[model samples]
Target: MPLDQIPDEKEMSFLDHLEELRWHIIRSLIAIVVIAIAAFAMKDFVIGTVILGPSRTDFWTYQKLCQLADLIGTPALCIDSLTFELVSRKLSSQFMTHVSVSFVVGLVLGFPYLFWEIWRFIKPGLRPQERKASRGATFSVSVLFMMGVLFGYFMIAPISVRFFSTYQVDPSLQNLFDLSSYINTVTLIIFGCGILFQLPVIVYFLTKAGIVSSALMKAYRKHSIIVILILGAIVTPPDPFSQILIALPLMMLYQFSIVIAKRIEKREARQNKES
Candidate 1:
C-alpha cells in the first residue's frame, strides 16, 4: 500500500486518510468562513434584530405572550418593560463582540453543512448497514438543534432578560450590563439549549448499544428532572421562572427520549425473537 493513491472511494493508507480528513476540514472551514462573511456584512441586522432581540419589550416573543395573555385573560402573562443599559467599557469591546457574534451566527447558519462534512468523514468508516441505520441523522440533528436554539432565544433568553432586568435590590440601583456580557450570555444559552436538545439522539444510540433502556430512564425520571432543572439554572440566570422555562422543554425532551428508547428496545426484542 502506497501513500500517494486516494481517489474518493479507493482504499486509503494512514497518510491518505489524514489527507482526506484535512480536505474535508478545509471544505468545512471554507463554508463557515463564507457564512461568517455574510453574517459580518449584515452587521446591523444581526446585532439589532437578533443579538438584542430578547432585550426589547416589543420583541416577537413578548408580543405573542401578550396575545396569549389576553386570550387566556391572564394579564400577568404579558411580559414587558425591561430596564437595563448595555455599555462597553473597553475601546475594542464592540468590534470584538461584533466579530464574535458574527462567527457564532455563521456557525449556527452553517451547522447542517458543517455536520454533514463531519458525517461524510465518519460514514465511510461504518458498515453499509450501520450507515443505513443512521440514515437522516444529519437532518434530524440539525433540525433539533435549530429548534432548541430558537426555543432558547425566543423563550428562555427573553424570560431571563426580563427577570434580571426587572429585579431590583433598591429603587436607586440600576441594572447595567456589559455589551459583551449580554451577547455572550444569550449566545451561551442558545448553544446550551441546542446541545441539550440532542437527548433523543443520544438516547437512541445508547439504546442501540445496550447502554441505556426505557425502563432505566423511567426509573430515574425524577433524577433526570432535577438534573434538567440544575442545567437550566446553570445556563440561565438564577431565577426560578427562567429556570423553569428552560427546564420544561428539557423535561419534554427527556420524556420523548424515553419513548424513543422504548421503541428501539421493542424492535430489537422482536428481531432477536425472530432469529
Candidate 2:
C-alpha cells in the first residue's frame, strides 16, 4: 500500500496499533514455524552434513587451514584429527535436539522475511524522509547476518571445535563430548557472530536518533580496540593467533560503523540546511 493510503498513527488508537503489531509478529512466527517444519523433515542432512561438518578433519575449513599451514611451513596448523566423540545420554535426546536444531535453522533462514514483516509494520509510522532513508535496511541487515553466519561456520566454529576437541589435561584422558553441548557451542557461536555483524546498522540508527555521533566513535577508538580485543578473546580460542584473527574483522567493522555514522551526520546536516 502507498503511504497516502496507509492510516496515520494519529488515526489509530493504542489498541489498534497493538493489534497491527500482533498480526505482524504472528506472521513472522508462522514463517519461522513453516521453515522449521521443512528443516525438521531434512533433519538427517542438517545434523550430519551442516551441524557436524566442523568436527571432521576433512571439512573445508580444516582443509584450507592445512593448505595455509603448508604454505607457511607450519605443520601445527594442519589439523589431522579431532579427539572427541559426540554421545547422547538420554533416550529422547537425539529427537529433542533434532527439533531444536530445526527451529534454529528455520529462524536463521526465515530472518529476512521476518524482518520484512517488521519493516512493513514500522514503515507506516515513519515520515516519508525516514522511510526513504531506511530504503535498504532490510536487505543490508540480512546480508550482514548471513555473512556473520558463514564466517562463524567457516572460520570461528571449525577452529574452536578443533581446539576444544584436542585440548587435554592428561594424555590418558579422552574427550567424550555430549551431543547437546556440541550443538549449543556451534549455534551460539554462529548466532553471536550474526548479532555482532549488525554493528553498522545499529550505529546508523543510533546516529540518526542523535544518541551516537561519529565524533564520539572516533574519540573512543582506542577504548573500542580494547573492547574488541576482549570480545575476540571471549569468542575465539584462548590463543593469541585466534584472538587476533577475530579482532581484525571486528576492528574493521568498528571503523566501518564510524564511517556510517559520519554519512548519517552529513546527510542530516544537509537536510537541516535545506529546511
Candidate 3:
C-alpha cells in the first residue's frame, strides 16, 4: 500500500470496513447527543407540553375532537379529562425519566441523520444498479418515518391514553399510572410506528431482489389487512376507533407497497425486453 493513498472500497479489509462503520456510528451518536442535550435543556417545554400533552385533556388532538363533537352533536366524543393520577414512586424516578425522555426525543428528532449515516455506510457496498434504484432513499425513508411518528403521536397516543386512563372495571377501581411508564409507552408507540412505516422502502428493495412481488402482495391483501388490524389492536388501546385509526394508514401503506412492487416489476420487464 502506498503511503497517504486512499484505498478502493473493494480493496478494504473487514477491519477497515468496521473502522469506517464505527466512525459513521460515532457521528450518528454525536448528532443524537447534541439533540438530546438541547431537549434536556428545554425540560419544561419538552416534558410538560410535548410528553404530557396527550395525557391532558387540552391536547391539540383532544381539542380537535371536541370541535368535531360539537359539530356532530356528540358530546360523548369530547374528552374532558384524563382520570389517572401519574406518580413517581422512586425519589430519583423523575430525574431518570427526564434523562431517558430527553434521549428518546433526540432519537426521534435525529432519526433522519442517523439513518443517513447508516445509508452512507451501506451505499458503498451496494451495486451501482442497486444504488440507482434506491436514489432519494434517505429522504423518502426519513419523510415516511416522520409521518408515521406524527400520525402515531396525534392519532393513537392521545386516544390510547384517554381510553386507558378512563377505563374502569369497577367503580372502586382507580387508575394510577406511573410517570415513567406513561411517557415510555408514548415514545415506544411513536418509534414503533415510525419503523413500521418503512414497509414501502423494504418492499421496493425486496421486489428488486425478487424476494417479493406485486402478485404476492395482492394475493395476500386480505391476510395483510387482518395482520394490520391485529397490529393496530396490539399497539393501540383495545378500542375499535383506535384500532381502525392505526389500521387504516397501515392498510394504505401495504397497498402503496404493492404499487411500488408492481412498478419495479414493470421497469425490470422493460429493461429485460430492451436488453
Candidate 4:
C-alpha cells in the first residue's frame, strides 16, 4: 500500500491494527520455525561441533589465548584441557537439549528476517523522514548481532567454560556438568552478547527520538566504565585477566556509541538551523 493509503493511528480501529500486527508476528514465527526445522535436521553437526566446540582445548578462543599468553609471558593464560564432563542425569534431558538448541538456532538464523518483519509493520506508521533516517538500521543491527554472537562463542564463552571447568574447592572434587546447564551457558552467552552489542544502534535510535544525547553519554562515561567492568567480572572469570579481556572491548563499544550519538546530535542541530 502507498503511504497515503496506509491507515493512520487515529483512522484505524484498535482491532484493525491488532489484526495487521498479528499477521506480521505470524509471518516472523513461521520463518523461525522453518529455520528451526533445518537446524534440527543438522543435529549431528550442531551438537558435535557448534554447541560443544567451546569445551575443547583446541577451540579458537584457547588458541588465541595461548598466543597472547606466549607473547606476554603469562603462564596462567594456558588452557590445557576442558576438565569437566557434560552428562544428562534425567531421561528427558537429552531431548530437552535438542529442543532448546533448535530454538536458539532458529532465533539466531531468523533474527534478520524477524527484524525486517518488524520494520515492515512499523514503516507504515512512520513519517517519510523517519523512514529515511532508519534506512541503515536493519543492516547495522544484523552485522552487530553476528559480531556479538561470534565474540561470545569464540572469546567470552570459552573463557567462562574453562574457568568453571577447572575451578575446584578441593583436590577430591570433580566437575560433572548437566546438559541443561551447559546449554543454558552457551545460549545465554550468545544471546546476551548479541543484545549488548546493540549499544551503538540503541544510542542512535534514542538520539533520533530525542531521549538521550552525546553530552549525556559523555557525562556518564566514568559510571559506564565502572558498570562495564562489573559486568565483565560477572560474566568472565574471577581473574583480573579475564575481566579486563571482556571489559576492554565493551569500553571500546561504549566509546563508539558516544561517537554515533554525537553525529546524530550534530545532524539534528544542522536540520534545526536549516528550518
In terms of TM-score, the best-performing candidate is: 3
Off by over 4 Å in 1: 1-10
lDDT of 2 by residue, 1-275 (tens): 32335656448768777888888888899999999999999877898999999988889999988999999999998998898999999899999999999999999999999998888888888878788888899999999999988998898888888878878989999999999989988898787787778889999889988899999999999999999888877766676766677778888999999999998898888989999
Expressed as tens digits, the lDDT of each residue in 84-152 for candidate 4 is: 999999999998899889989999989989998887877878888898899988899999988888888
Task: RMSD for all candidates, in order, please.
Answer: 2.8, 2.2, 2.6, 2.5
For candidate 1, lDDT tens digit of each residue in 196-263? 88888888888887899999999999999899999998888899988888889899999999999989
Which should have the higher TM-score, number 3 or number 4? 3
User: What does candidate 3's lDDT look like per residue over 73-139, in tens digits?
Assistant: 9999999888888999989999999999999999999999999989988877777798899899999
For candidate 3, the lDDT comes to 0.89
Question: Which of candidates 1 and 3 is the stronger one according to TM-score?
Answer: 3
Cα miss at 129, model 4 (Å)? 1.9
Residue 7 deviation, candidate 1, in Å? 9.2
- Model 4 weakest 10-residue run by lDDT: 1-10
Clashes of each: 0, 0, 0, 0
Choose the strongest candidate by lDDT.
3
The C-alpha local distance difference test score for the whole of candidate 4 amounts to 0.84
TM-score of 4: 0.91
